[model samples]
Target: MKSTRDTHRFSATTSRFLLPTFRRPCYLDIIKTNVPKSLNKSNIFHKWTEEGQAPYYTIINDALLSDNYNILNQNMIYINNLREAIKENLHQDSIKVYRNLKFCSTYVKDEYKEGMTFLWPTFSSTSRNKDVASTFGNYTFEINASTNDFTYRTDISMYSKYSYEQEVLFYPYSGFRVKKIIPDARIIQLECVDTIEVESNSRILVPEQVKIFDAERKMFVYFYKDNEDLHWSHADTPDQMYLIGQNMNGYWDSHYRYHHSNGYFVHKGNNLWEEYQNEQFHASFQQI
Candidate 1:
């Protein structure tokens, strides 16, 4: 079997801190000094005070590493909140939420040979509830972990960028299909997408040009292709490789998208952003 050494188990050493802490530091002095303009223009200073005086802090110790106060795995709080919500609705404490507990990142190959980092969601639920797999016929909940709102922290710089040609990383993808789309003039300009996946029977139709475009959205798109074959095919490996692409629509003035390839991508930016991104991307190796 073809094996991909992409998916990695997260070790404690993989991260320094979460993105929020980096963007909006938890320290009061740091926030006040660095973002003085924000404080002066808005009620941020007052909000900081409110945070300091939040009712829970008086009753619960926020700094402790106990179950009640997990400084490390902040995602646990989201999990616990979900558990409580489920318990309240179902009225069953037996419904349990569990996780691998260890932090693991999946990597993939991208335009930049260096891998990108995608933080895996460690939460899973167990219940006396009916088996969804048996009833639904083995359906899977694929978290579009590539999207920014997934709430998992991603560290893209975990690996340095390299060349795709020089690096010979093997991935366990069953194969990929190249699609040539000719969209309506009114719709967005997404003409071609190369889907590298484990299982796909989708067909590819050649376009008039080596590159296809939608005159409507005014964008340039290309999919990965092998030199010899019209399609890229590979045998399934023990460890599967998943590709992630992030569309950073509005990070910069030029209309472009930022692409991050891991098991998935971790995107940043709000809903209204548009194209042209001075892209900084890397690949990741993942198992699934």
Candidate 2:
């Protein structure tokens, strides 16, 4: 994820007072009466979808897009609570959602060409009603997604203040592939996919021998061929090894983190491996 300043700015002085406003009795009463009691304990979902006056959604999303650890850390409790609420309310089947944005620049239309894959680094709010989405802007995104896919999304309509909009919330770091673009309609069609799937589709070739410095572990890791299979060994635990194999797509990947985990690392190139877990970038190993 990359850091971006909030394009829509509020007064810095008043912004500090916004969060505490949610603690008021009126806000609590509204949440308690409207949302499920179990999920409303923290009122995170209500806060997230609240409109006007209390811009919790914008504040939290701005922090996420900022990619500032300190800013994110300050809001982690609310973020985690909201995540748990969404997880509890996750949709069971595939869904279609729409989002409309007023683009100040042509960066999305220009850079995100059809068939290109990209990471949407911040939490996204969408609507099940196309007409409702269109009320926001001309550049509309029509998304096809699966609950079982590599993204965490939930039907937040039941929890939203504006329930008529039929809101659906996608957590941060959702992976998307541009399926098609209708220039005439200003519409972009997107398909949800795993981040690793996108990285593996790259044309970069894996090297026979590779050494990378793991920033998270603060150690050098080595990968080499052994008995016709590629294996990796950490410098701190050289005796322990993990195997890497080519998938049906002919991309090299390894599930070294945990058994039965959907997360893994894919060799994106000779000098780089992209690690994805929980539909997000867990880490990256760069050649040292």
Candidate 3:
């Protein structure tokens, strides 16, 4: 009679999917609402609040590419490299994409004969003829990898200011839409996308200017100004500072658009870290 005893254990580890009684057009669309209150939009701006000041450029810096599909296809050479960088940094057990900007595969080299120092060349993308159409939303960018420096297309163009008559400068939206996203330092144009519609008051995009270190010139840029401070000298990593209230229209700056009644999205690269200390980082995973 050490007799037999029956025991059973049930596990709830099985993965489950959200099943709905009825599905509607883009039913899963609003599901973004269920994201935990912690990871939700409100607390997402943690980096912003921690910062010293919210300059006019309080908006996050998001660099959108005219063609993000290239990334989905892996044909986007630069982005593929960027994806790898993201995977490496997070030390992620696995990359999990839950929402906008899905996580795609990364490109890795097998040969370890030697290490590689990857560098993205910097180039400027600007508007042509000072109009909104050509330069405002979509940029006709010039990739200058050989030099590793990029400038705004308008910077090279004859006209630098915003003009309506000659250059149909497009200004359309509500509250505010980022009109310009400038890199604080010289960096290679890694990846950009055409349009991403985000309807989250908890989160917003801003113009974050960042600069890197240059040995040749002790100071990265001769002169720099943000909404908060006047000058920056440190060169350890990229410094993200903003000078608020100067935009195409609305509260931001001379480049930001308020809100386009037309619903068609212009190019807005969701806030991101252009380079992770000379490396690259994914947007959602990184901070302001």
Candidate 4:
């Protein structure tokens, strides 16, 4: 009985400091009996705490509450440090990629006032969202033989420059095909292109002389074979992704295209781009 009375007395003395919120199931139960009957249970205090103040027999000690507060603060600090470390690791990996790869550039020899320069976007595992894949993947190249020779194991494969369409060739694709480009009779010459990827069961009838015109709107992607009256099949439009060519079967009867191999091309052939590209390219940085 004495101990109960003493706890009640302790709460009564601290009544003025405690605010009302005793009605709810809270720590206020600890001092409920000590509260004066005249005090309302729903009042707010001058300050706020995790637990609202309430009158009870045993007042919650401030010292014990402070120990818990210190522990919570330390946990928050630990979480912040962990998050920062993860970001730093990501940044370091990005830097390492830049230092390793040797970067090269490409561009046109002359200036163009009005033309849409197209390029296939390369996949960057870091910069792009990992869940999404890059739709535009394959790209064609002029393959400047002297400077960009694929003879070396590390060199990139040289393809046609007019990479407007995805041409489809026949089964003998393992065999090479002969292709050439010629400038049309005009004041301004047309932009050059190349054949990158060919689909199966399609044949492009090559013409005697490659024709050139102002292909501003990304028109047909065809190749000239020889003096033959027939022209090789070609894609309808540059914007169209799929190129379908027909199988060539005619007088030559060789099945092999022209005097050349089916489609096997040496890097050092034709009026390919030779001038050094003076443009700057960021090979390492991410799109982000």
Candidate 5:
């Protein structure tokens, strides 16, 4: 729900789709017109919203992935409604989900590397049944996920038109660490992991020049600025106080540090720096 602007201009195609209809109102039309004004103020009517084969989901998901803040703002209302609905119906325990995707051979080879972290920036749909997932494609993703305060996911099968699919929805910007890859079986195992805290009106701030020495690698890791701040840091820390820089792999490797008592910027314990360091140190060893 974090956005820079209040107003948004939709694409021509999306604008046309969102127009009110007088003859027979579609789901979105009803939402734009008939949904009570009081409910809009209260922001409580979203609980009644269903996730069936509505065209709005496509728009919402697309907007979530877009770089344009205006596009996302345009769909903010729908997105908030869906998020509230999902939160209201979230499962109490951990669950496993599956998704199948068809990728170009080159893309799979380049992007699905083992030990890499994959982020779903848009609302993603998965299935509770592995069989249903397999029917979609040959490349299967086996995800272990849970619902918690930081992690947002829900079993939306009850609200979906295709209830038999047993759909599980992961909210936008969910992070998953790739654990294993079985090339023969075309299965990729992933575990849900928390990355960075996302806040509204926040943008990445990078230092002009900063480099860290990797004693293990025997080389210096260079840093570059990013347009957006996706890496997680302490919520209490002011946005301007935190900085993010990408390493050679285009991954966030900058340390989230605070001023120490000794007048040094020291990395915070139990944060992204710890995970990155651990991963880097262990990456050189081959699994026997």
Candidate 6:
């Protein structure tokens, strides 16, 4: 019989939790504590090290309509149809959630006859004003089918350059005292959210910007910027991109408040290929 320790071969990647390594002290008088070390240096471990861990966020609300829920509850027809279509297109297994992001679902759109694509509420805040909120943190997801797979790349830029004035709520501990204050601050620097390359058998059209909503003379727009390297010559199926940003304030303690933007991009169609390149696109974000 194998020993317990032997049964757990050190693997840096496949292991879901942390594995600290033992090492000799580098200095005579100094000590290092809590240094996470894992075995086998696998892809998963490397990802955690480089990007930190994926965060758990609150699911603010439900995602689907009652009719859709009834359909799924009564039978597997819709799901089965979608699975078969995607499988046929990708020549592989059925669709599976990519990175296990907070909320993800699939629906059959009229445009997609064989199968549907994945959808997620891109941002946490619903403010239509670009100056209302911002988001930070970086994560990548990959969805697999039978023979092929596609990666949904999300890179939220926490650093840009923008300043605005907004009302803030100050919380006082030990009581229900609420204070409102307006301050001129760079709620968040303007950040760029661009969708990475996708991979699949079908034509996955990149996202385009539209005037989503406007109120009180404030305009909120969703637009795509073409990958500069790819000129208009490739318009129909050109390498595309989209940019969005917002500002909001979060308060946890009476003395502290945090401000950031919520901006992101998701591919619009089926399994296309988005290269998981590690190239740095811009300067590092300054934590707020």
Residue 270 accuracy (lDDT) in model 1: 37
Model 4 C-alpha lDDT versus the unseen true structure: 0.19
Q: Put the candidates in lDDT order, highest first.
A: 2, 5, 3, 1, 4, 6
lDDT of 3 by residue, 1-288 (tens): 010111000000110011011111121222222322232222222221222343111211111111112222332233223222222322212111100111112211111012111111111121222222222222221222111122111121122122221210110111112223223321112221111221222114333532333343333321112333223343443364333332221121112111111111111235221212112221121122
lDDT of 2 by residue, 56-164 (tens): 7667666554333455556666666676677676675788988776653365544557886655545677778887777766678899997567777887767665677
Among these predicted structures, which one has the highest TM-score? 2
lDDT for 66 (candidate 5): 31
For all predictions, the C-alpha RMSD in Å is 23.1, 13.2, 26.8, 35.4, 15.5, 25.2
**Candidate 1 regions off by >4 Å?**
1-123, 130-212, 217-219, 225-288
- How large an RMSD does model 1 have? 23.1
Residue-level lDDT tens digits of model 6 in 1-288: 111221101111111001001111121011122323232223221221122133111110111111123323333332223222222332222332112112112211111122222222211111112223222111112222222223122111111111121111110000110111112321111111111211121113323222222232233333322221211111232234333223221111100111113212222223211111122221111111
Is 5 or 6 the stronger prediction by lDDT?
Answer: 5
Model 4 Cα lDDT, one tens digit per residue, 1-288: 011111111111211111111111122122232322322111211011112234210122321121123333333322223222222322211111000011112212121112312111111111011111111211111111122211111100012121121111110001112122111311111121121221111223222443322223323323334323323222354344332233242122111222122221111123221111122221111110
In angstroms, the error of model 4 at 281 is: 26
Best by lDDT: 2
lDDT of 1 by residue, 1-288 (tens): 111222111111112121110111122122132211221211211211122234222122222111122342333343234223323332211121111112222211111111112111121211111221112211111111122221212121112131111111101110111122122211111111112211121112211212222234433233222211111112333123232234221111001122112111222233222222223333221111
Better of 2 and 6 by TM-score: 2
Cα-lDDT of candidate 3:
0.20
C-alpha root-mean-square deviation, candidate 2: 13.2
Worst 10 residues of 1 by lDDT: 165-174
